[model samples]
Every structure is written in C-alpha cells, then in structure tokens.
Target: MSVRELVVLGSASAVPTRTRNHNGYLLRWDGRGLLFDPGEGTQRQMAHAGVSAHDVDWICVTHFHGDHCLGVPGVVQRIARDGVAHPVDAAFPASGTEYWRRLRHAAVFRDTDVIRERPITGAAARLDTGDAPFTLTARRLSHPVEAYGYRLEEPDGVTMLRGELAARGIQGPLVRRLQQEGRVVAPDGRTVTREECSVPRPGQKVAFVMDTGLCDAVHELAAEVDLLVIESTFLAEDSALASEYGHLTAAQAGRVAADCGVRRLVLTHISERYGAEDEPRFAEQAAAAYSGDIVLVQDLDRVDVPPRRRAR
Candidate 1:
C-alpha cells in the first residue's frame, strides 16, 4: 500500500522554542519523500518523526536563511553516514551555489556521493526527476533573499466505475485490457470504449510556499492545489513586521488559500514570540479569511492529503 502524508518535523521560525523546533517538513508521497526547508535541528527531528535519511529523496530549500537551510550540513552528513543507496536530489536558488557547496562539505566526513545538486535559476525552473510519477517545478517568490516555492503535479488518470463495468459484463483480465487499450471488443463484437466504463480524475497537486510576501507567483503556484504548506510567520497584529521581513501573516496565508482554491491549507513557520496559547489565534485569523480546512502545524504532526476529487 502507498502512503501519502505531511510529516511536520519542525515548525518554528527564526528561533525554536521549548515546545517547537526549527523549520522542517517531510512530504511523503507514495513511496518517495520530499523534505522542505530543513532548519537547524532537522537531523534529530527526522529521527523523532520515525523517518530516516533513506526516506529523503529530494531536499528543497526555499532560501539560505539559517531557519531554512541550516540543517543541510547535518542532513547531508546523515545521508552519507547511513549510506543511503538511492540518489538524493537537492534543489535551491542558483545564486546560493556557494552556500550549497559549503554546506555539502561543511564538515570533514566521508562523502558517499549520494546527493545530486540541481541549482534553480530564473523565474521558473523544472527539476528533472527522470521517470518519477510527478513533475516538480520551482517558481520565484518575493522574499528579501533569493527564494523560490516548489510545486508538484501528477498526470491525470482514469478511475474505473464498477457499476458501468458490471453492467457491460466486463471483469477479470478484460477490465485491465480495457484500461490498457482504452477499448475492448465485446463477445457480441461491439467496441466498448474506456469512457463508457471510467471517469476522468484530475491529478493531485501540492505547493510549498515559504518566506514570501504577497506575489503573483505565490498565487500561481498555489492555484487549485490539493495541499498547500506555507509560512505564516506572524499574526495580523504584526503585519508591519511581516511586510518588512518578507513573511506572511495568518490572514494573508488564508486569503491566498481561499483565492487559489486550495483544499487544505497548512500554516507553519510560526514566530517564536507566539506560544501555545497563541496557536489558536493563528487558526482563528486564518479562518476569518479562508473557508477551507486550515491546519496549525506542530512538531511531528502528520497531516494526510484529503481524498482526490473524482469526476461524477
């Protein structure tokens, strides 16, 4: 069975509090894992989340801020230390090439040669994931530093309708043949098309937006996605500070989710100033803007992507 969920390794912003860790998120899609914006304590946080270096197939860095990419050294070291057999790909802003190199070799550890660096530049760049089920792309976001958001799109597929299939007496290997060929010959020599027995299913989409102020790319990447994991570093009361630091408030994040038709919105990268008591305020402010489901993330929290929408 395939598992799909978001494992919140850490959700704190610039500073980690006693209850929250630094920024980190592991998106588990089917059998593959994509780790995003791993900060200082990601290595230990992964262990606590019951995930290992082997689970990480892709590392996406939104920016080089300490709260975003500080854990690269430890994560790279652990990937080498565990001798993970699969090749791990790392994507980040091309302008941060020097930072990427320094972090990869930050320490004098034996290199296992497992990581593949794919530096992203320009307004939008597609990362090559040869033969992967989904396509991954990065789009520039409006951050003080060079930053980018990530989006994943799966190809559209067809879902079999049991009622239609049974009505046509199609079953067993004939069902598979119908799916594979899009048409199957009936015993009466009639040509039955896949459309008669299946419904078109829209592909699943996910977006990761962090450390960005309001921008067109933010809306573009988030448009109609099933799940959007984004940074909400401040409450509405701190709108000025959020604007100065190029971060989003809970209300802004929620508005984006509502405007983009996001099904589930995950609010993370919470400021250190907010404590357990203030968590509810984030949800409340976001609720005031978006009617969709909103999740205020916590360390080690797992949120599953809601069921895929199918054509009626």
Candidate 2:
C-alpha cells in the first residue's frame, strides 16, 4: 500500500503563536518524504506530527526569511542525532549560499547524516537522484529574496489491456513480448500493436509554492498539478495587505488553483490572528471563487491527495 499525503508540520506566518509554529510542511509521496520551509520549531513540530527525520529524503527552502528557513539547523541536527545513514538532498536558492552555510553549521552536533546541498541559481534545474521514482524541478518565484518553488513529477505507468490480450489469445511470454516490442505475432497469424493495448497517461505532479506574491510564475509552477500546496497568509478582506507584503490571500490562492487546473489546493502558512472561528469561513470564501477542493491546513493535519481521474 503506497501512501501520498501532506503532513502539516507547522502552519504559522512570520511569528509562532501558542497554538501555531512558523512555516513547515512535509509531503509524503509513496517512499519519498519532502520537508518544505522548516521555520522555527519545525523539529518539535515534526515530532508532534508523528514524523521522524529518518523519513525525510529531501529538504526544500523557498527563501531565507527567518520564518521560512530558521528551523534548518534543528532539522539538520536531528537527522544527525538520529544517525540516518542515507544521504538527504537539500535544495534552496544558490544566492543564499551564505545563509545555507550559516544554518547548516549553526550548532553542529555529531554529523552522521550526509546533507547534500543542490543550490538553484537559474530559472530551472533538474535533480537526478539515481533511481528515485520521481524527478525534482525547481523554478524561480516572485519574492523579495531569491526564492524557488519545487515540483515533483513521477514517471508514467504502464497500462494493461485485457481486451487486446484476449483478442489475440495471447498469454505469458507473448504478452510480455507485445509490451516490450510494441507488436507480437499471434499463433493465428494476427499482429497486435502496443497502441491497441495501452493508453497514454501523464505522470502525477505535485507543486509547492510559498512566500510569494501572486505572479505568472506561481501559476506556471502549479499548472495541472495533482496537488498544489501554497501559502494563503491572509483572507480575502486583506488582499491589499497581502499584495503589499508579497503574500497571497485566500481569494488569490483559490483563483490561482482554479485557473491552473489543480486537482487539490492546500492553503497554508496562515497568520496567528485567524483562529478556529475563521478557518471554515476562510475556506468558504476561497471555495466561492474556486470549484476545486480546498483545504485549510492546521498543525499536524494530514491531507491525502485526491484519487486521480481515469479516462472514461
């Protein structure tokens, strides 16, 4: 049983309140675990979310703001403290090399885990992780400092066709041959092509856009994504303030998701001022603009990705 879900590690904007921590999100895709933002208190937040540093295979930072990257030290330290033998890749802005270096060694404990840093300096970069199931792509976003949004794409899967197999009376080796060679000669002198048996299906995509104002790049990054996790730091009423601070309000985030064909939209990095009373209403306001699924994230909430739509 493979699992794909987003574990809300922390969901607070700018400052940590008594009920919320700064920004942090853990995306669990099958065997891969990706940690994003990792603001202050992320280490403890992970524990509260029932995830361990051993489960993290990738670390992504959207920017260098304290509320976004301040937890890097603790997360790195915890990985070492747990003695995770596997190396974890860390991706962030190449321009923030100094900041990355500072936090990486902020208060080093015994270094047991290998933290490989792949800095992003251009519009896009592809990370080859040997034989991982998915590939990671980082793109530039509209932010004050150097910021990048990360996207994960899984390779396409093979579609089995029982109709073609039955029509050709093919089984065992001949079925395998048809799949590998795109055509197989049947005992009855009939030829079966792979196109007759298989259908093209695009790989699943997940995008993370944080700490950015509404921009074309944000829509570009999230277009056609199966799951889009973005920051909705304010409500619809504060759209102006959100724009002034380079943040997205609920309405803007919802409109972006609807326009981009996102299957599921997760709104996170909320301000502490929005309490329990405001959560449902915020989601409602966003829903009024977008027809797609909307999730108002809270600390330690687990959101499963909606099932993929199949060809009718």
Best by the lDDT measure: 1
At residue 204, candidate 1 shows an lDDT of: 91
Best by TM-score: 1
Per-residue lDDT of 1-312 in model 2, one digit per residue for the tens? 888899988888998877778989998988889999999999999988889999999899988999999999999999998988888999989999999999999984787548898888888878766678888888888877878888888887567578868877878898888878989888898887877877766788899999888777888889899999998889988888888888888888889889999999898888877777787877887787789888888789999877765733
| Per-residue lDDT of model 1, residues 1-312, tens digit only | 777789999999999999889999999998999999989999999999999999999999999999899999999999999999999999999999999898889999999787899999999999998877899999999998999999998889899999988888888999999999999987667788999999898989999999999999999999999999999999999999999999999999999999999999999999999878889999899999899999998899999988898675
TM-score of each: 0.97, 0.94
Window of ten residues with lowest summed lDDT in model 2: 303-312
Q: What is the lDDT of residue 163 in candidate 1?
A: 94
Model 1 has an lDDT value of 0.93
How many angstroms is residue 12 displaced in model 1 relative to the true structure, after the best TM-score fit?
Answer: 0.8
Candidates in order have lDDT scores of: 0.93, 0.86
Q: For each candidate, C-alpha RMSD in Å? A: 1.1, 1.8
